[model samples]
Target: MEFNEIIERIVKSTNLSAEVLNSKINDKIAELDNLVSKEGAAHIIANELGVNLIDSDASQDFVNIKNLVGGLRNVIVLGKVTDTFPVTTFEKDGKKKQVGSLSLNDGTGFARVVFWDDSINIFKNIKENDIIKVINAYVKENKFGKLELHVSYRTKVRVNPDDIDPKSINATDKQSKAEFVDIVEIKPDSFVKCFGAIVQVYKKNIFFNVCPQCGKSIKSDEGLSMCSEHGKVSPSRKMFVTFVLDDGTGTIRCTSFGRDAEVIMGMPTIEAIKLADSHEDSTFPVDSIKSKILGKEVFIYGRTSLNTFTNSIEIITSRIVENIDYNVELKRIAEEVEFGDKN
Candidate 1:
């Protein structure tokens, strides 16, 4: 039987229900099992169950900035004060008051908490690596288009030495892998993906024959063409080729040749060599490329690659697919850009 069915049978046999179960205890046991598993058992099980394993969503106990919403009840969180700002005191005559901001994280996510005068004394005692509990905190959007959580007068802060144990927090901790499409949509510091075809080839350098003395790239010594750099020598001609790939949104040039290039281009050994030999300094027109790309959609993702030899940029791609809706992609890109501007 499947895992879920087995779990259900066990629960039915025991006549146990969530109302009688201790969430913290169960979470701890699961976390322990996950930690001991060969490969992230907790996350794997959570994935199989379609559960949001990580506590990524905002909670009333801990108000994380990334998931903050205006006028929402904040979360209670326990984490070390990873970073702290200086406490600035405003003075009026003989009176003085303290104020500052601090950032905390427990590897899952982060939150910046601002402290006022009364709370400054409590926060001032907070040192790096000190685990503290925050209650009744909330998040608000800052001027720079980022969310920040602050502790108000009603909020309470306390240092819990027992909670210093990482294992205790691990039992409650959760994390999720980034979604491929969401990375692009959310603009949350992600890698770029694309796909397309080879269209043209160009021979940048070639050695026709060899020199009698110096073995280097030389021009043809025959009357057909006199060597300008060399006195009188024949050199081998070097060959390189360029290929253009078309995706619905755009056509990109991926210039490569030889065995590796032929494999990706799906060209025969002889055909690949012929294309490389034709140093036609001509490129397929943009209109023709657009027409080809309009029908096919390929998938690619990678950081930009630079060609040191040719002093050009070639984007690396993978997972080529065809017949994609370019308009949908365009709309997604537009929305992501617009949303990223808010952050």
Candidate 2:
């Protein structure tokens, strides 16, 4: 039998009562399986054992804070919901009212918990620094792709203002541990490293024909790129980069927009515009943008937004480091370029 199986069997045969030993043994088995799957099992065991499970492995679920929050379907976290502050909203019925969001945080991370209508009353009564336990909450993405956690009809939430210290609650710090070791906490605006490869580079002047109906680029009959679907409609000039990065949990998209694109890609605004213009009617080579960052692992620090619709992050405040410490791969690339020159 495997080591865990042996332990489970041995723990079972012990003179100790089955209730005490079985609960713990089963929980251990569940934990060994994977972190995300163990949550429910661990929570159940915690109830029976009267002990909190700390720092198991959120790596599986938290690929990136934004991506994880965006992709989460049904999840449980030990956190608190912020009391109502102030909110304003316009209703579909042509009515407008001030509303507030219940910000939920377990000290490790936070999510905006929206309360509407009658639910607003319950939230308004909550005081700041209150500790709340949340379960069965669903993750939704905002317009900007930031993940916001919501309390569904089936969500189970427990609120206790006096028993918990909003600040004292220890949370798992996945990123920002290396460089910011001196910092006791990860602030919202603090910078964190993101890893990914540059899959695309866009310049505002580069023109590519896209389908008017789907917004997908298509080859124009004129030999110049034009959205034949739109027939006479003008093509848009915008730069977009798609990159894949992993945070020891899972791989996610890292995007840069507008000015951020110029800074990260080292392309001046006017130059980028000119490049876009040259490619406007045809598929331009991604060389200028691609050569700067191709298969290399680049590090970026910026704001991450969770795309709820696509279940990914749209990294905005991003800047790239051309030369990183991962030298072994770069050296190989250097050799390859040298050989190509010789040919």
Instruction: Write down the lDDT of every candidate, Cα atoms only.
Output: 0.46, 0.49
Can you write out model 1's per-residue Cα lDDT over 68-154, one digit (the tens) per residue? 564444356666665555566665356775556665665555666667657888888887556777776655543323344567665
**TM-score, every prediction:** 0.33, 0.34
Query: Which parts of model 2 are misplaced by more than 4 Å?
Result: 1-71, 80-85, 94-99, 142-145, 161-168, 171-343
Query: Measured by TM-score, how close is model 1 to the native structure?
Result: 0.33
Alpha carbon lDDT at 311, candidate 1: 56
Per residue, candidate 2 scores C-alpha lDDT tens digits across 1-343 of 2334433444444555546655665667666674533335544444455443333533232232334455465576555543233444544346553345654555555566654444555566666556665556656653334345555445666677454456655543333232311112223334555444555454333333345466766665665555645554545445545555544444545666544455454565456667655866322424566676555545555655557798644555454433222244334335544654685
Listed per model in order, the count of residue pairs whose N, CA or C atoms clash below 3 Å is 34, 11
